[model samples]
Target: MSLAEKLCLTAAFVFFMTGLLTGIWKYRCMARSENAVAPRYVDIAHRSSLMYSFAALLLGWFAGYSAYPDWLNSVAAASALGFFALAIGTYIVHGVLRDTGNQFRKPHRLGRSTLPAWVIHAFMIVLIVAEVGGSLVLGSGALIAIW
Candidate 1:
């Protein structure tokens, strides 16, 4: 496998392992809760980790099939994978802290200081662009390879 594929698949494996751990945590949290629901962020972390693991697998497949240079493919895959890690890490942090269930609510706060709404909006915008743009790059390369 190319470096890109290896990188993506490795990340996928890590995400899968994290998902398993988070799943156990979710179960424990649910057991402790009278309402039988885990902390919202814990559930989100578990689900997102699993989902992103599959996404990384897909990215690895595309990377393997891409016609682009291995370095370029690696960059593309890394871009998306980086964002996935960031999001998962954030979710895990919130899960551990049991922070606000909704991070986007009015007057957002990272910890003690209030976070500007635009900061979150900007991050969302950048994340969308990076994830979609990177996938498009790899997908286009794979399509080219097929054709």
Candidate 2:
């Protein structure tokens, strides 16, 4: 791959590693709690999010780096952010929604998770915007300056 491609790949790989770390921390938090999330369920979410994130990463890299066009970079960067933020965050939100959905079951205090669902949604939105904007600026500039 070209230098630009390599740079994008490095960025994505770094992001993925961060995601992995976040996943591990979240699982650890769950495990310590009385109402711990199951490993199997966590695994499923992890795998799903990882796959989608990887897809976004690769696609964005190729489009931004290989093609090196403004529009292409914009598209790929936005896509990278969207898929990574939404798809991964969705799994987490859905899990909480599912757990809380059961009216009959009154669960324990889930630390800061006691916050309303809207908060999580809003956080995800902010993260997405930041990622997309950041990626576009960084990737686009890199393509221009380096490639």
Candidate 3:
């Protein structure tokens, strides 16, 4: 397998494991809650990790078929994978802290200090660009190779 494929598959496995662990955490939270509901962020973390695992698998499949060189494909895949990991990690943090249900709500404070709205918006912009741009690169390469 190409380096990009290996990297993506590895990430998929890690994400899947994280999802499982988070699922356990969710169960624990639910058991402790009077209403038997897990914290919103814990559920979000579990769901996101599971979804990202499949997304990583899709990326791996594309990377394997991509016409681009290994280095280029790896770089492109890494961009998206990195963001996916970052997002999952953030969710896990919020789950642990039982923080705001919405990270983008008014004030937007994941940390002690209220984050500026611009920073949150900027992060969303970069995340969209990285994930979409990187997927386009690999997907286009795969299409080119097949056609």
Candidate 4:
């Protein structure tokens, strides 16, 4: 596998580990009190981490098998890794803070923290564009190779 593929796989492993750690935290919290509802973000983090890990693995495999150039694969892998890391990190922060309910269901008012919010949105947009664009390039390359 190329270095990019390897790095993607490594990110997958890190995500899996993050999931396991979150799971442990959830279990401990539940064990401590019957009425304790595991933090919404904790559950989200655990589940999403596992899902993202699988996604990274699949993306890596696709990149490896496809006829795309190494640079394309590198971009895809890097984008996926960045998104996964930031997403999980956000979840972890929310979980740690035990913030007000689900941030998704009701948007939290970020009165003074516009910069962080803007940065996150920008990063997410760029990463998603890179990932999707890379995937398209790789898919086209594969199709061209087959014909």
Candidate 5:
């Protein structure tokens, strides 16, 4: 496997570790008080991290199967990894800081009006486009190779 693919798999492991930590946090919160519930963002972060990890693995495998150029593979892997970290980190921050309420259930007002929110959303958009666009190009190249 290429270095990029290896890195993607490593990211999957990291995300799993993050989930484990979140689980522990939840357990502690429950132990402290029967009525205490783990922060919504923490739960969302744990679950989404797992999903993103799987996505990273799938993208890595697709990149390898498609025999994408080194540069393209690198870009796709990097974007996937970047998005994964950003998502998990944001979740952890929101959970720890408790700046907003139940982000999973309701849209935060900051997302609609804040400059920082706009920058973060824009960055996520760019990463998604790069990762998906690269994957499509690589998949097409593989199809052409087969034909």
Candidate 6:
């Protein structure tokens, strides 16, 4: 198979994985009411998992778009690097302040990145947000917006 095909498959896999993990994590979070082991942290980790899945989707898009630059995965390595940096920064800010970021001005509540797990979860939420947001913003939008 060509590099594009391989990347496409990889991207598809990532998308599927993201959806799958999100569903499972959602289940676990809900199940916590029934089971003691099911803590909110599972959801936190799943949030990041969802982000990975999104990043994969974007990379796949980039790959399927064209087979140029073997390293140019769908989101671009540079973009991924930036995403990670954002995740880390958000995690740190939330952890230190125990509150939502002032810049983004999100409400400061339970998911304020107080614990390590919360930071990771925030990272995932932020990551996927960036992924989907990037796709919408940077993408040509032909495939996404048929309207």
For model 2, how does the per-residue alpha-carbon lDDT over 1-147 read when each residue is reduced to its tens digit? 443344456656755765686588568867887878644334445666566557556555545444355554555555455556565655565454444432223332233355556665676687677656556655556566665
User: What tens digits encode model 6's per-residue C-alpha lDDT throughout 87-141?
Assistant: 4344434433444433244333445333445665686787777655544433443
**Where does model 5 exceed 4 Å of error?**
102-117, 134-147
Model 6 spans > 4 angstroms off: 1-5, 11-15, 18-22, 34-38, 66-68, 71-147
lDDT of 6 at 29: 55
In terms of lDDT, the poorest run of 10 residues in model 2 is 102-111
From the highest TM-score down, the ranking of the candidates is 3, 1, 4, 5, 2, 6
TM-score of model 6 (CA atoms): 0.37
Can you list the residue pairs that collide in candidate 3? Answer: none
Q: Could you tell me the lDDT of residue 99 within candidate 6?
A: 46
Kindly give the stretch of ten consecutive residues in candidate 5 with the minimal lDDT sum: 106-115
Per-model C-alpha lDDT, please?
0.91, 0.55, 0.91, 0.74, 0.69, 0.49
Candidates' RMSD to native: 1.0, 8.2, 1.0, 3.0, 3.7, 8.3
Task: List candidate 4 segments past 4 Å from native.
Answer: 104-120, 134-147
Clashes of 1: 0
How well is each residue in 21-89 modelled by candidate 5, as lDDT tens digits?
887876776677667776677667777777877877776676666655767776767775776788788
Pairs with backbone N, CA or C atoms under 3 Å apart (clashes), candidate 1:
none
Candidate 4, residue 119: CA error in Å? 4.6
What TM-score number comes out for model 1?
A: 0.96
Which lDDT tens digits does candidate 3 get at residues 1-147?
A: 999998899999999999999999999999999999998889999999999999999999999899999999999999999999989998988887766889989888675667889998898899999899889999999999999
lDDT, residue 48, candidate 5: 78
State every prediction's TM-score relative to the real structure: 0.96, 0.42, 0.96, 0.79, 0.76, 0.37
